[model samples]
Target: MDFALVGLIASLILLMVLALKGMDLLIAAPICALVVALSNGLPIFATQEQGDIANYSDSYLGGFSQFLKVWFLVFLTGALYGKLMEYSGGAKSIAHWIIEHVGMKRAVTAVVLATGILTYGGVSAFIAAFAVYPLAASLFKQADLPHRFIPAALALGSVTFTMTSAGSMEIQNWLPAPYLGTTPYAAWQVSLFTALAMAAIGIYWLNRMIHTAYQQGERFILPQASIIASVEAEQQQNVNPLTAVLSLLAVFITAFLFHQDYSNNALVIALVAGCVVLVVGYWRQLSQHFTKVGSEGALGALIAGANTSAVVGFGSVVKATPAFAFAVDAVTAIPGSPLVSAAIAVTVIAGITGSASGGQTIALPILGPIYLDAGANPEHLHRTISLSSGVLDSLPHNGYVVTLIRAICGESHQSAYLALAKMTMVVPGICTVLALYFLA
Candidate 1:
């Protein structure tokens, strides 16, 4: 038992360390699984049962394959939908329209809201960040706000209020359904309130940060020559805004209408329908690179699916360990409402994993059944779990944060991450507590 505990700790630390260092999760996951298997006294590849238990291959591969079987289509369709939107200029068009109407005075709000629109419309968060950055840069420059705050604005918009909110097309919103037997719209009333509160608080805090920075004599500086040239080239394209609006609306309408009937697969159908709409509505706009776009979408889906599946595989091995059982038992035994307990457990695991969706995928397989058995409301559990996952998963080591801060915006963590923490982690954490109070 002591050895199992040590192994669990070692595996978690190794996983987080490697993931934060930017190692491919596909490589890191299997190695972590090996750590757990060795500590648990499990055979690595024997099909024969040890006593009544299955071998490591069965548990690890079982989790990996199960997630793929149930969710490959959703991942494929979501990624493809995002790619099609990117290729059709729909995403950029939407961002530009929002910025145009919002104007420069409210530049931060404009960027945040624009990102929210694209994210809820099924564009990947990474893609949304890329699509919105140029416009955000321009808007910040016009407003004289510091450029460093751009990541916070983007993270707040894309990952916080919109990503896990009810009716979100993001995978985080869809992942709980299979485990809870609920729709992506589960606990929507509570979800709506929580999302609004998060937005309100986050925006207020974000503006305060910008105001403080402005008072400190910090202001927007011109981007690199290469970045400006790239942004200029992108803006030179001719794309209609109406077509973009309609394409996004197609996704929302289809998903909203069909979600109840199809469950998790509803997202698949909606994404497919949205893709058809984009192709038909923007055929002339998309014709030049349609084949390349499709291929890229497929490749992107593979990468996204593989990353998520690898974590699920790691989770499978962990759950089979005695230490995992002990931890779950300890968590479930916590006094107070089960909702609070669920929130804490999910948040901690998410912090450990550094991926919101990955954390939920892992915690739910074990936590879901236990919470349901304790008579916890599945809707409440689902919503709380979803929101909680977003809270700590935005830690500096989080995949999305790293991507936004370094890769996308080209800013150091030291300069930009505090504001991000306020919007994504601090606000969301408070919202989670409020949600537990109201919904539980």
Candidate 2:
């Protein structure tokens, strides 16, 4: 193996190891990127770089700044909107309604379905996690389910089927379109089948794990320093469940109507609209909390966005390495069916980058034309890579996985990642394989 390849693999391993050990990404990402740069013979500064060789400053900061610029507002307003729902008691109201109608025993399913509804409706998964987690915490506590499973349930709904299914507005699903000359709804029949299978299998796996934990006497255990206030000086004002749902509808409906022309900007608008509805619907409760909500929400937004951006910077450095190019070449050259090769290629790259969309963006441009020239079906290639991108992308170091486990759930990776892996990685891997076989 090339020395650069050795550095790339070692740096990824070190990154994940540090992440599992609870090192902050803002620090760890730069440290790991330095390793990649040193080993790959890239210059530390742009002024020192030779032709076509990316320097650490240019590549790392470029990815970091680019992600933040694109996503920070969405994070800001989404967190603020979620905070409004939490502070106003709207999320709790929805939880109570679900308990009454859906029954407490089905709390896990409720979390999954609620998140799926939001994600499929064009809500950012980060936003969906924020919006649904307060409700999930309430439902899990009421049902006595272990809080550790919360991350998995949220990920299962947000990242698995809903993310990669045909027509999903998620970047992973739609990313292959321009390169493959296919629509977002490419290979609808296979995509739908794979999606449903993934959902059913993942839900079953999650519930089974929760049930087994319950049998072993494990139960809901809220953290001592929980982000949610266990008690408040001002009693939570009662919010009507139906009326509270209007806020969610605002986000979904607005994103649905304006997505084509506005794209991600529509999500920012949708989240702001949701916040507007929440403020109006629960003004009596939220009016006094407004200053606190905005400050806290903005802080949360910075933390989440910065954490994910740190990893994106790491991926950016990895992308610049000769090893990444070599890996892409090696994967695309795999013998046999283009569909299988494409699926494997995307999955491996996604794992390496710890991002589905990142992997697809890198791989499709190279793989698309190769397979197309070999007479591959564009729609099949589109759907296959769509599903494939979601598979290995959930490895422990993934930005979403790290954010979901540590930042959002307040659970350490040690406690939360196993269930997450079973749901997001294993179930999605199985479903993708099934799609490949059927499509083959």
Best by TM-score: 1
lDDT (10s digit) by residue, model 2, range 1-440: 39999998888888788876768888888899889988998888865336555888788888888778877887788778778877787765664565456666888778888777666745567767766777778778878889999999999999999999986656566668767877667899998999899989988888899999999999998765445655232223367866568987887678667756665666678778888888998999898999999898899889877876777787788778888778777877888888999999888878866778767765776778998897789999999999998999888877778778877788887798989999988999999999989875
Report the alpha-carbon TM-score of model 2 versus the true structure. 0.82
Tell me each candidate's TM-score: 0.93, 0.82
Index of the highest-lDDT prediction: 1
Lowest summed lDDT across 10 adjacent residues in model 1 is found at 223-232
Residue 273's lDDT in candidate 1 = 85
Specify the poorest-scoring 10-residue window by lDDT in model 2.
Answer: 228-237
Q: Which stretches of candidate 1 lie over 4 Å from their true place?
A: 1-3, 47-56, 222-233
